[model samples]
Target: MTAKTLFEKIWDAHVVAAESTDTPAILYVDLHLVHEVTSPQAFTELRERGLKLRRPERMLATLDHSTPTLPTAANGERPYANDEAKAQVAQLESNCREFGVALHGWDSADRGIVHVIGPELGVTQPGMTIVCGDSHTSTHGAFGALAFGIGTTEVGHVMATQCLLQRRPKTLAIHVDGQLPQGVGAKDLILHIIGQIGVDGGTGHVIEYRGPAIAALSMEQRMTVCNMSIEAGARAGLIAPDETTFAWLQGRPQAPQGAAWDAAVARWRRLPTDAGARFDREVRIDATAVKPTVTYGTHPGMAIAMDAPVPPARNAQEKRALEYMQSQPGQPMQGMPVDVVFIGSCTNSRLSDLREAANVLRGRRVASRVRMLVVPGSEAVRRDAEREGLHQVFTAAGAEWRVPGCSMCIAMNGDLAQPGQLVVSTSNRNFEGRQGKGARTVLASPATAAASAVAGSIADPRDYLVEVAA
Candidate 1:
């Protein structure tokens, strides 16, 4: 066989049928994750067509987008305050029960963000095609799975067939060199990449994030890197599964058992880009050059150094972004007052992320002027954090430690920063109105978010870490 890129290898492995180069190929899905917001329409379509799910066992459903961070009742059973939000959650429950598909509702110990639970449950694995009705589905690629988001119609298509007709995406390889400097993390690394490539630089491509720096990151960190691939306009992003990947999966609930696991590992080892493999485009970045980064504009690409002044608006978009953020060009955001700090999202809400943030907040307190939230990504994450005393650290620091869900990352629910307020978040997108109406959001790492919560501004984590160290 000819040498092939990792993306080609994974895509080909799942191709059930193909006719011509121009037509979409039938790619079998190994995992189908659904959520309340998008899956409702897909399920309704299935019902209207009088179609039963082809494979209920292959599908998983969860409630996150509309679940409230503040539970309305004890025992973690909370109905969304908004009737529409409550209906979405209730509809998903009814659909899953009727379809015989398993659901990880807010009541489930396994519940949280769809992307967060997949890997934790041992369901997300290498050499598999995974699809979700949410854009951040690219997050699963950290396990070496070929995962991406699908629309409502496509969601219905997969439910009935467990297959998708997809045209092959061009491959782009991004290589990183050396070690990341202290205080720099996967969030900073990806934000820098977006800034360099521009928002559309990755259009029509499936990005393979490779090289030493990528290989060095833990599975959680790798997930953070892959989570934002869509922000770069790529269909998905993946890393070849290795020891770090295998170690994280070995004992998860859905992982292959014993001998089956060994065989899976052997195949995953060979799935890396073959020597002399070709790519449509390539980018290289030095890990040392990355710094603690934060977005100053509405888009993820409009980022500058955490302590530096917002760059002079170079385009109309940046100009408008500056106006929305209510900041002047060339003014440092370091001491700029922050009204809120959000330190959770699929992008950086994993245990490692929480640990890093907790490390910064251990002996410190949230600034009196700022409202801070440290939401876990999943129920399992929340439970583990509580056991590890992470929850106490966050709460003791004057931050609200909330239940797991996609809280404040999107304003689908009511967990949003107030209009016109400046929010420093650990979520992926920082677009205008993403957090709430007229809300200005700056994206950063969990540690950065924690630091800003302490300083009441967009403070740098390195300085705070040093303070804690001292």
Candidate 2:
């Protein structure tokens, strides 16, 4: 076997010994976050088996995927009127209560998207193993943890044993060099990389994001980068813990306290790859070459610079994706008309993202022909943005500022794009019908989305940003 990379070392450390080559390996899971969509079936399985959660204290449950932005304003009103959704949330609450797992539900100030709540609450620390039922659980990897999504069955496995059987994945070091140009954000950078690597280039591997450009991103930006690792066909994405990670951890509820904090930081400082560590694969990207980007086809990788013409469908896969997206090649992404603009999701719904969108939209009105929506990733983010008047900016721009949840990103709830409607979105993933059936979605940065919302068409933020700065 080759000398292990940091990801492999971390994985081996978490392994509680293997069962068999085909059977599951018992790998300790430091944190388990349960959400409504994936927990119901797992809970059902547990009830059927007469098994309780092995260690409830290590698990946290919340309702997000199925919760609506509105709850009836009456006595005993539930936020979700869908009976199945209500049951899922109710079951999760019951499971957590009966098994003593902590829960943050609709009324709880701590409630939000599981991925969003974990890091904000300090439950996702560096050098930890975190798993959730949601695929974007990789978002927590921003803290330098081995975080990834699991299936419902695997969710049960984690609940029953606080361990999972996972195959050791190859490691790919994605070295992003140089500083990102002005107006380019993490979303743009990841999109640019995906465009270069193709969506499935990192299959069967875990990606370690490294180098000056990757290290320069803020915690939220790092989350945005790692959140889309799965789109690149990586099992997970990680960054080595550093001062930026520690600064974000301090003072949070689950973060270490007093001297414990100092000790934890000291340990985190040592989490980087040791000298001479080896990776199975490597890719390099120049951040300075990346510009504002948008997806023109169904896949995230089928993207180009905002000002560039759409690429021709050169192959079978490209042709299929292009046909599904109904996009013509060689057409400029900019000035492409849109019907809806969405700014939220686990990928780019943090407070800073909201602030950036707000800064771009301030004193500007969204086009009357376009409908815009802003959904905060979590309740805490929603509250903070409102306190800072970010909501006001969105609303003033004729955008609907909804409550916290993964609205429109996965379409689990009522928020979805209408058929044939083109949407300019900040959320990751623009795959076929990702927003809704026949609804075209173009992934862009928050600034780009804001600019598009105002212009009623795809437009670069640099165009408006320069004028505003001037």
Candidate 3:
């Protein structure tokens, strides 16, 4: 066995003890979060097996994807175009009540995206193991926790046992150095890394984000970086919990308090990889080299600098991806027309992201042909933004400021792109039909999305920010 990195050490600590290579190992899960889209089947399985949730207090449910974006009236009925979506939300509510799991539904102010709510509500903490049905569960790993997505069957296992039989994944250290360039954000950095490594490069591994650049990022920015680790096929992505992480956790509902809080922070401060710790694989990226990035093809890896033209892909897979995206090699990403722009998701829906987009949209109107929407990750974020007057800036610029939900990031709810429309979005994934059937999605930073919305094409935010600053 190789010398373990911090991820390995953490995973080893969480293992309750292994059975055999084929047999599942009972790994402890500190947190379990469920959402409407993936929990109904698992809940049904639980009912069939006559198994109750092992730890009701450790698990929480929220209605996000299936809940309608429309505001509810005093009668409590939402304006949902699809009854089945509402039915899923109802099912989740019922299952959580039946299993004694805490739920944040449409009526709850705390409700939002599962990943978003976890960290915001203090349910996600350092040195914990968190699992959810959604792939973006890596979002919690930003707090230096072991977090990953589980399939429905695994969700059922967690619901019943509060443990997972998990295979320990190898560790990969991704070192990012130097300060990022102006207008470059964590979304740009991750997209650039994914472009360099290809989407499948980190399969069967856990990635530990390190180096000066990673250290310099705020907790929300780190969350954005880890959130897309799943897109690169990593089991999880983490940063060692530091002062920033501890500061973010202080006073949160689920975090430790009093003597326990100090003790927990002391433990978390020691969670970093020991000096000379070895990783199975390592990759280094110079943050200064990353520019405002945009995806040209369906996969997150199929990206290039906003100012640069797409490079020719000599391989068959590259050629196919280019063809599917209707993108030509050597074509510049700049000046490419877009029909829609979205600035929200688990990846970039935090208050900082909204503030950045608002900064770009202030005193400028959105392009006449471009339709823009800003969806806060959670109800709390929506309320916070409105309190800070971010919503006014967005609406004044002709961008729709909708209720909190996973609006157009995924088609789970009623909001989605029209068929064949191209969108510049801040969401993590750009997989085929990820936004909607036949909708072309280009992943970009919130600033870039705002710039694109103003220009009606793929434009770099640096251009606008410089002009506005001057």
Candidate 4:
């Protein structure tokens, strides 16, 4: 038998029909996660075609992109961003009910971001193929699952038949060599990778992150890294399953139990790449060389170390990004005034991320001119943080404690930055107007966002880490 890469192992196992040069392969989908933003149209397609869902038991739904992060009003209303947002939520509810799919609706304590709750409930596992209508679905690949985003048409197709036609993507091996320096994390490491490879570096490839540095990260941190693979133009990202993966999944609500758990682990242990498995391409980085990084332009790839100045634009597109960001070549990102700071997103909204931010803001206060928001990725995360007094740490530091929702990350949930305001955000994307019309977004990690909130500038998290230690 030929040695197989982790990706090939999973892909081959899930292939219902093999791929040919002219046609795509028919692949089985293990899980289909649904959300309000993208599923309504897909559901409409299904209804129009009179197609009953093929596997309702394999589907999970949630309302996040359009749900309000602020608390309900005195009237017990949800405070939806708009009537359309409310309608989208309602339609999803209707669709899920009609299709007999389980939904984590507003009344459910489990309600949260689709990506966040999937793993929280242990539904995401090794060697499974998962798809969602959202691009950040790559986050699920952290569990060694073959996960990727699908379009509305694909969503409908998957609902009608629990399979998808997929063209094979070349595998790219990203090897991180050394331990990350203090104050730098998975978010910074991914940003550095995008900087090195450019935005389209992983086009037509599924990246497999491996190395001692990757092995050193916690499960949540690995998820954080995988979540942003879409921003690099990758079809998906994966990390081989290990003891760390099993430990995180063990005893979770939906995880296998007793002998089943033991058997699952035994099978998962075989999912990693074989010794001689070959990748289409490989890139290596020294994790120690990566610094706490931030994006200054309109794309995730336009990033630099927090201590460095903006680099000269290499092309017309880069120049346009700099102009839109109100920055000139050689302008320093550090100490640049920011009007807002956001410390939550699927990219970095887990308990570990909140704790990292809280450690920076524990004894500090947000700058008087800065507006800071700390939104959890899920209800469970919110409850856990409250139990740990993380919410109090944020609020006491002058940041608003928001409920679980996509919130400002999508800027469609009424939490948005004002025009021309510079926002240091922990969200994955930094595209212009992503947070709001004319809002300048600087993507950073949660700790970096917290530091920037307190400093009212694009400050280095290492400085705050020193203060936190002191």
Candidate 5:
């Protein structure tokens, strides 16, 4: 028998029907994640067609995007961005009730950003096929799941029949050797990867991040890496299940228990790519060379080491990105003034991420000229951070500690950057107007974001880390 890649193994198992050159394969979906913003339209389609969800138990819904990160008013009314946002939430509740789907409502302690809550609840597991309307759904791929985002129409299709028609994406293996320097982490690693390969380099492929460096990363760090695979144009990102993966899922609310867990781990252990399995393509990176990195332009690919000068654009599109960002080819990023610093998103809002940022902010103060917001990824993360007194650190440092939600990541919520402001954000994308109209976004890791908040500029996180250690 031929050795099979991890993706091939999962894809083959979930295929209800094989694909041909001109036809797509019918693949079974193990989980469907729903959020208020994109799910209403999909549910509407289901209602119009008189269709009920085929597998309600396999779905989990939450309210995120467009939900204000701020708490309710004194009158106890949620300060939704607008009536449409409020309506979307209500519509989701109605649809979930009508379809018999489970929803983590605002009052639920489990409610959070869809991607964050999925793994937190242990609903995302190895070898499972997961889909959601939001692109960052690939975050679940950190656990070896075959996860990807879908469109509203496809969401409706999955609701009607717990299956999807998909063409298998070719596999791209990214191998990283050596150790990442202190203060540089998963977010920087991914940004560096995107910089090396253009934003579209992973087009038409699924990326499997492997090697010693990848294996050394924690589960949350791996999630941060996979969460941005979409920005690389990959259908999904995956890491084979290992001891670390199993350990993270062992006792979660939805994870299997007792003998069942043993059996599940046994199964997952077999899911890694078979030795000598061939990939369609491969890219190798020396992790030692990676540094605290940040995006200087309007896209994820236009990034450089935090200590390095911005590179010159090679094309018209590149020039436009620089112009939009108000950046020049030889400009130094280190001391560029930052108007705001936001550290939260599915990509890097986990507890560990908050702790890392807090480490940099402890006994420090946000610059008088800079405003900073730190939003947790979920209710659980918020609770955990408060328990650890991380929130106190943030607030003491003069940063706003926000409620759990997508927050400024989507910019549709009440949390947004003012026009013409320069933002150092921990979110995945730095696209034009992503945070607000005329806002310039610089993508960085949590540590870097916190450091920038202190320095009022794009500063190296290592400076703060060294001080913290001392």
Candidate 6:
């Protein structure tokens, strides 16, 4: 038997019909995640063709991208200000029911960002193939799954056949050796990786994150790292499942139970890459050297250390990004006044992310000049945080506590950073007009966002972390 990379192994397992190794292959999809923003058109396509879903049980639908972060009205409808937004969410509910697929619709306790709830519900598992219309669907790859995003037409294809035609991608191994220093997190690590490899570094590859530091991350932390794979131009990012993965999946509602659970664990334990597995490309980073990172310019690739000065532009695109951000070379990101602080996204809205931010926020108040918002990723995350009084901690610290949704991650759904305002955000993208038109968005970790909210400027989280004696 030949040693195979995890990506090849998983891809080979799902190959249903293929003309050649390089040509299109019909691949079986084990899980299909859907959201209202992209599913409406796909649903229309399915309806136009008079096609019924091939596997309704494997399809999970949620209203996320177009959902309102504020509480829904008494009638249980999302309080979307725009008629189009309201109708899009309604269309999803109608479509899911029409197709006999289970939906975690708006205001449902299971309702949340599709990516966040998939793992929380145990629908995402190791060695499975998952797809979503949303780009961040690569998130599920953290569980050793082969997950990727598809287009609306592809969404319709998956809906009609529960399979997708794919060309296998080359593999890249991102090795993060050593232990992370204090205040450096999965968010910082991934940002550093993106900065080192550039936005298009992994363009033709599916990346496998290896080495001791990646192995040390909690399941949620690993999800945070893998969630941003698309930002680096990778098809997907994967972390081999281990004891941590099994521990997180054990008792969840959709997870296997009893003897089946044990069997699943035993099988998952073998999904890691073999000792001699080869990859097409490899990059190594010393995790101990990674600092608390922040994106100074438009793209996620233009990241710098929290305290380091922004380097001179390397090209026209770099120069343009700095101009759009109104930032000059040789200036550090710290001390720049922030108008808003947003702490919610599939990238960093897990309970662990929230708890870290709340720890920095206790007894501290946001700057009077800044508007701060913390939206949980899921109802389950919100419920867990409230049970621990994290909501009170946020509210008392002068930040708004809102419902779970993909709020402020994009400029959509009425939750937006006002034009000309500078926002320190936990959301992934900082592309031009991503948060809102003419909005200057700076991306950082949740802890960093919380600290900056209180400081009213781009601030380092380490300055705010309370040292606990070991």
Computed on alpha carbons, the lDDT of every model, listed in order, comes to 0.90, 0.88, 0.88, 0.93, 0.93, 0.91
Which ten contiguous residues of candidate 3 have the minimum total lDDT? 1-10
Off by over 4 Å in 1: 19-22, 74-79
Candidate 3 vs candidate 6, lDDT winner: 6
**lDDT head-to-head 3 vs 5, winner:** 5
- Residues 84-202 of candidate 1: C-alpha lDDT, one tens digit per residue: 88888899999999999999985689999999999999999998899998889999999888899999999999999999999989998999988899878999999988988888888
lDDT-based ranking, best first? 4, 5, 6, 1, 3, 2
Candidate with the larger lDDT of 3 and 4: 4
lDDT of 3 by residue, 121-164 (tens): 88898878999999999999999899999999999989888899
Q: Which stretches of candidate 2 lie over 4 Å from their true place?
A: 1-4, 18-24, 74-81
Residue-level error in angstroms, candidate 6, position 382: 0.4
lDDT of 5 by residue, 1-470 (tens): 99999999999999999999889999999999999888888888888888888999999999889788888899999999899888888899888888898999987999999999999999999999999998999899999999999999899989999999999899999999998987789999999999998789899999999999999999999999999999999999999999999999999999999999999999999999999999999999999999999999988988899778889888998889988888878877888899999999999899999999999999999999999999999999999999999999999999999988999998988789988899999999999999998999999999999999999988899999998778
Clashes of each: 0, 1, 0, 0, 0, 0
What TM-score does candidate 2 get on C-alpha atoms? 0.96
| Model 3: colliding residue pairs | none
Q: Which scores higher on TM-score, 1 or 5?
A: 5
The superposed Cα distance between candidate 5 and the true structure at residue 191, in angstroms, equals 0.2
Candidate 3, residue 58: lDDT:
91
> Which candidate, 1 or 4, has the higher TM-score?
4
Colliding pairs, model 5:
none
Q: If scored against the real structure, what TM-score would every candidate get? A: 0.98, 0.96, 0.97, 0.99, 0.99, 0.98
